[model samples]
Target: MTMTMTMTIAGACPGFRARLLLGGALLAGSALAGPAVAQDMPAPQKDAAPGLTKVASFEHQVTGVTVSKDGRIFVNFPRWTEDTAVSVAELKDGTLTPFPDAEWNGWRNAKKDQVDARNHWVCVQSVVADPKGNLWVLDPAAPAMAAVVKDGPKLVEIDLKTNKPARTIAFDETVAPQVSYLNDVRFSPDGKTAYLTDSGASGALVVVDLDSGKARRLLDGDPTTMPDKSVTVSYDGKPLRRPDGRGVEFAADGLALSPDGKTLYWQAIKGKTLYSLPTDALTGWLTSAVVPSALTDKSLSGKVETVGENGPADGLIISRHDGRMYVTAPEENAVKVRDLTAKGGTPTVLVQDPRLRWPDTFAEAPDGTILFTTSHIQDSAFYKPDAPAALPTELWSIKPGAAEATGSTTAPK
Candidate 1:
């Protein structure tokens, strides 16, 4: 696995000595209360029972999931609202085992005990595997939205074989001091560049030069980058608002690089519009004067089509063989697909079940079966109640048939 560490943080661990990596930001508010309801998925498929084979499940709530090039599944659990012993694990031989033990996880959680700062691992927003087979773990470093600009907020890269870190990326007071909860990251097809989304308090795209190890935020709060206010996102049945009065807009959660590697598409959790830009325009290396002449009128750069108007939007993946884009729209209790090439047909509805309570991430297997996770988030203490849930959160899979494929094929990256 490839490990990356650029900016240095005082308490940050150099590598992955354990399974869990914890980050906490202290914001004022009462600590969230206890055991959430056992949330359940919607009813099974009606016709053929759209076979949903469970790959794995964890006792702690799972937020993000990803698969390595070799097909090994890596999952991360942020030590956020819940009291947790471990933060990350791997599914091997159909069983979940700690990829790294607690010592490593504890180091991730440690913070200054000074009266002004509180220590805790808030949550892990993204888990991604690079082309070189290294796993990149993004730790938002701040717990609960308390702004910790210095000695906090980092990205840790771990070697899958040794479970050790190759590098750590951090920011201090000189950099933007507010919380930079680094979210999803995607590698260029050539693997020469990496683009990360900052879904933190300051929403922006942080572009990193992999070869040079340089990083900076771009489209910083630009109109195209900000979230739209008209869209309301619900998890199960309730809207997901920050504990504070501010509504959760510009979540900047779901990210995808087009098959050609020229366009980067993104959507906010609280946004209804889908926006994209030429990769060259968002790198921050070019000033408006030097920006490509082709990069003008972002609204004309891409069109934002309406997906179902419900629930929060999370992970997104584009199929290599069929040119279809799959997204998780958890409010409607379903996983939806849009044919990128369709001229005017309605987007096909893939799976919409109550069981998919709060589906977060989406990954397509080599064979075209879509894999995703269900958090039952709307039913959780963070969003809803603390009682026995009627349904269980599960990992679900759906296989696409030959008819799903169009006449064209995606060129190899």
Candidate 2:
């Protein structure tokens, strides 16, 4: 078998594929994904331990951050607090400057207006610049996580050089706007389409056809995409609850497309379980009768939760080199890795830091440096409006070799 296939299988089923099935039987119907006994998974090799050194931090509250192909960093400042302003900025020479110098407002297409002091986009939650150097702006424009607005939920495409939006795709009530807090996005390997996570009340996976400007929402409110009730996430050892006492939580936040672009893995912000589905099943452009069954492959039905499996995980990364996936767990103040080659290896803790507050997003540098954000969002005023604010939110980076060498990387299942 080719290395890719061999690794995919190995990564998914370490040495105890059959044992994992037996384990699954114990939790039948619910779902169980594993290679063998969680304890039996071999301990990963430890040689060169890489550590997360504090690189750069933001003066104001940080929302989302994305690293460019050339290593330029872009971040979003949402209007979460009452008086604070909303804007997108770039990190240059260690200074945060207004990107394209525009304040947060409503969005418009490239043909509409240029970004200047007067006219700008608003309420951007996440920012991702694609491989082709196009910046994608995800706006979920309500005060905090409340999905009260309709016209403002949009995905704006901005040209890097001009800082002008080339296109603006708006979400309306028909598309369940209130339920669509558009979160993160990942481009297909070919860059022909982009998959966005609707982390709003009604969890969904939104797929956009870049060329046609057509968009579709699938797996809408599906249980797999939603966080289970029994799962309670404790940030920094503190239970995370909603400000309204209504159980504040997330359905999906961290998202990524596999290197081969065949599957999309995602997990809820407040959820402990991780789920994935075939990308082709989600594209929704094809009309084959067997498409439904293809979308529900039994192999893909297993639930991959790292609640107790891995540390409190966030920010997942899939290394193309070995088809292994990595996750950041701020609760444990660590980063973990699982080899898909073993199919179900136990997770290993690669990096841990008591100071790494709520490590959020992941970005890959050209030379394999893994970039991630540490927002300490749980400690923010948004979560505890009455508490004092923690300044100096940081963005961090570490190499895979460094992560594995240290106990930060998790073992395969």
Candidate 3:
């Protein structure tokens, strides 16, 4: 098994050890259950924050969550420790349906030779519902988060209205090296450019031009994208690590874009300092004719600004309602928000609950509700051998407001 991200505490034991990758998902039914109700998955998380309500539960582990402007929820599962049956899905009437179709998610580890990895979702890392009414899927294509599948890493755009793939931008070894695991993504308001985080062995930011289908890597090997050596991902006031002394080392995993689409924020999972840079600076060079990668990388590095610090985090999103950035604090089982308008904004705790085990990704619903998934990284099979391969996870949400004390938990349809 690959230990690219997420879950459980396996002490340094003698046996096969793999990746501890990251990803969170949600839904109302078991992955094996059809048209499920709340009963299909685990019950409500006890002691969850006020107004926090459970939406869906999945039998397979989940990492990313997104809501279309029209309110359709889509989530993705990474092939970290288990070969999940479905890579991406949509929640409709309390059921998880293979998004786009089963064919796109038909690739399997055991059946790798039989299926074309380039054409299917080998291991989907993130899914985003764009402002332009399209669904974009980021496929790192590294099953078990190990070797890069030849011709597998790509970004696909699906027309939400037609529910069909409208475009596919493939990534080569240069953009998605074998050691890289593209973690999360955000798009410019007009959907012209895309930003992604590389949370694999090496860290970097990948910029994609939607129109030209050309992509570039920026800040590669830089301290901002790479993990910070000083920070420790702690839980219960202690560093979260594997039995073998390995700690959470995901780099450039969390990301956010300003509502104006001018500033981009990202940080490493193994690091704490938040960083940002002007979108114009990031995109201008890409639009220019044939600039050398070295020059572009160096110029972009100079523009990088230290935003602030957030203890090791996973998912990040800027709320459209308040114009503030929301971050997932996995170690504390909480979510925090920072005001960009402030000169040096310090993030304040928004909510904390024991149920929010490794809160992963974030999405704003049409009604201004904040949705996220509890990836439960410290309690998954990746670290705990006895833990079931199909780790039980859930999607949850709350009304975004400082004064909002109570919300609904009666399982959304």
Report the poorest 10 consecutive residues by lDDT, candidate 2: 1-10
Model 2 agreement with the true structure over 9-41: per-residue lDDT tens digits: 121112211111112222322211122212121
lDDT-sorted candidate list, best first:
3, 2, 1
> What's the lDDT for residue 80 in model 2?
54
Writing each residue's lDDT as its tens digit, candidate 1 over 1-413 gives: 11211222123233222211111110111111111101111222233225443444445567667666655566766644553444556644333445444345453334452221112233556677776778877666554335543554666677877877777665443223465566778877787677777665556666677766666666555544456667776553456665553455545678888777777777777766556667876654533444322113344334433333323477777776577777777666666777766443434556665556678777654445566877665665554445332223455556655213421112222
**lDDT by candidate, in order shown:** 0.55, 0.59, 0.77
Query: Best candidate, lDDT-wise?
Result: 3
Weakest lDDT window of 10 consecutive positions for candidate 1: 29-38
User: Candidate 1 deviates by what RMSD?
Assistant: 11.9
Task: Mark the regions of model 1 whose C-alpha exceeds 4 Å error after superposition.
Answer: 1-51, 108-122, 145-150, 172-177, 235-247, 284-312, 342-346, 385-392, 402-413
Question: How much is the lDDT of residue 375 in candidate 1?
Answer: 69
- Model 1's alpha-carbon lDDT is 0.55
TM-scores for candidates 1 onward, in order: 0.72, 0.74, 0.85
**lDDT tens digits by residue: candidate 3, 1-413:** 11123222122112212221211322322231222221232333455455566666666789998988766778888887887767888765334567788788777788534488767898898999888979999999987778988889999999987999999999997789999899899999998999999888878888999999999887777878998999888876688777777878888999999988999999998888889999998887687786546313676788899988887888899988778888999987878888887756568777777777899999887656788998888877555667787787878776665214453222211
lDDT of 3 at 344: 64
Per-residue error (Å), model 2, residue 44: 24
| Top-down TM-score ranking | 3, 2, 1
